[model samples]
Target: MNDEILVPLDLSDAIAMIDRQKEQIAALTTENERLRKEIKEIKEKIKLTNEYVDKYHGLGDRSLEDARKVEREIALSQSETQWLNR
Candidate 1:
């Protein structure tokens, strides 16, 4: 045996539901924009780090390991941010 219950929503309830959905969309949009900005910033950091690494490597600098560590951290942060956006 199967039983189903159907509930009807009035005008006010429908309006409220729509309003809630709108608020959720707005919040999500804001979050998406923020994540995009964060990703952009991370990319910039990566570019700068790579440039610094390249410059130092050319000069046979000793802080290469530290720069690599920083690069890895930045990459990890970027991956996390991308996962969050998804």
Candidate 2:
């Protein structure tokens, strides 16, 4: 049989415990808000990065003639049906 006796808290102790828990909850709420803001900022940064990459991909020094020549070379290497399928 268990011999330990359980002790109950007085009113003051219970009130103190409640106040401590309230402070903890408030701190957690603030942290949650901060994390949400950080996630939004990260998402924005990712969007900007994707835009920069898309813009960078379009930057080219090739002339129209070079592009046509490359296309002709690719056409020669692969069958017309394969390109059509794509």
lDDT of 2 by residue, 1-86 (tens): 13222223455678889999999999999989976875675566557555655555555654444455555654564465346535
Model 1 agreement with the true structure over 1-86: per-residue lDDT tens digits: 12222233455678899999999999999999997888789779978897878777754546677697887888797799779868
Say which candidate scores most in TM-score: 1
Residue 59 of model 1 has an lDDT of 49
TM-score of each: 0.62, 0.54
Segments of candidate 2 deviating more than 4 angstroms: 1-9, 58-86
